[model samples]
Target: MTDENNKIRVLLVDDHPLVLDGIRSRLEDDPEIAIVGEAGNGEEALQIATQRKPDIVLMDINMPVLNGIEAAEKFAELLPDIRLLMLTMHDSREYITKVLKAGAKGYILKDVSSSEMLIAIKAVYQGKTYYSSGVTDILVNESSKKEVPLTDREKTILQLLAEGNSNKHVARELDISVRTVETHRRNIKRKLEVKTSAGLVKYAIENGIVEL
Candidate 1:
């Protein structure tokens, strides 16, 4: 009763029953956190959140009935007081961008240690923005590259390169010839003022084009 009032109420959202179970196992015993409710999809999350009115919602990025991003928007609209923290396997810069722009207070990878998860939840519950270490690195890299001028094709080739994809792979993926890939690489290097492949990779990361 009094203890429940003292704890941070959390609503768990995920599609897989096993995942919800796993999260429950990790968080159920924490004195600082209370598992107020569980929802299998975004719509369910909203319904439960309305009823439960949790302090923070720990949500997954992917789900069948409604994706986490869309649900995040809804949460912003209908439950503006409830903070959102995303737990997911995706570490893509694109996903991070969308989720942050959609109003998630924090984003942590699914593989983080339980302690880290608790840290994220409490941080958001306290009104601070939290991001997984990898996501943080991506964001830091982006700010440095914000001044770099890159074309769409050039950025695509650089991304594949940073991923350690050989020119052949980039060629096939882009449906362009290997020679064309080489040409684009040369152009990117020239534009970025880099002299080597290692330099290209460094620039790619600095430009926020690489996925963590």
Candidate 2:
């Protein structure tokens, strides 16, 4: 049923052993996918991925040692050819955007059917991005937004905020006055139509405003 030469080698990374086991069992039924390795945390995942060089990795968002986003960033830097797919229970836009920015090629909810999972794996392995139906609304809403350009300074300041830096801290780090940082923050909020700092951070992370 599977073309051995065309098979996609997959690595599963989740802190929960039961979830990993379920995913492995479901995917094992498909001849086109081969479970090459498994890891319980992001650090272990990095080690396993480096050793196995899997064609695709199914990464979970929340882990103990290292989060999925961090691991994805490292993997992208170290193994650019390896496709990363986020497999998580969270359907939040903030989480989705973070993973995408970290270099994940696909995002699928844990409740996805076995068939859908297989298709997503195949799609990401072929270099196409995929999102589950549950989170498709977020993508659609984001796509409908009108583009608003930002200045270089504003962009830099926004990136710092996205990385969880406070306004005062960002000002100090950027060698600018606190008033200047506040001004830039207001300008960024106006441009993005985001009323709060949290909203701005979410937008920045989702849009890949700052390199992880």
Question: Evaluated with lDDT, which candidate comes out highest?
Answer: 1
- The Cα local distance difference test for each model comes to 0.84, 0.81
Give per-residue CA lDDT, model 2, range 15-44, as digits (tens): 999998999999997878888899998899
Error of 2 at 177 (Å): 47
Write the residue-wise lDDT of candidate 1 on 1-212 in tens digits: 34888899999999999999999999988888899999999999999999989999999999988999999989888898899999999988788877876778788999999999999998878765667787778666555546668888888898887665779989999999999999999888888876655456555655678754
* Residue pairs clashing, model 1: none
- Estimate the Cα RMSD of every predicted model relative to the unseen true structure: 14.5, 11.0
Instruction: Give candidate 1's error at residue 15 in angstroms.
Output: 0.4
Backbone clash tally for model 2?
0
Off by over 4 Å in 1: 142-144, 147-212
Shift in Å, residue 178, candidate 1: 58
**Residue 139 displacement in candidate 2 (angstroms):** 2.4
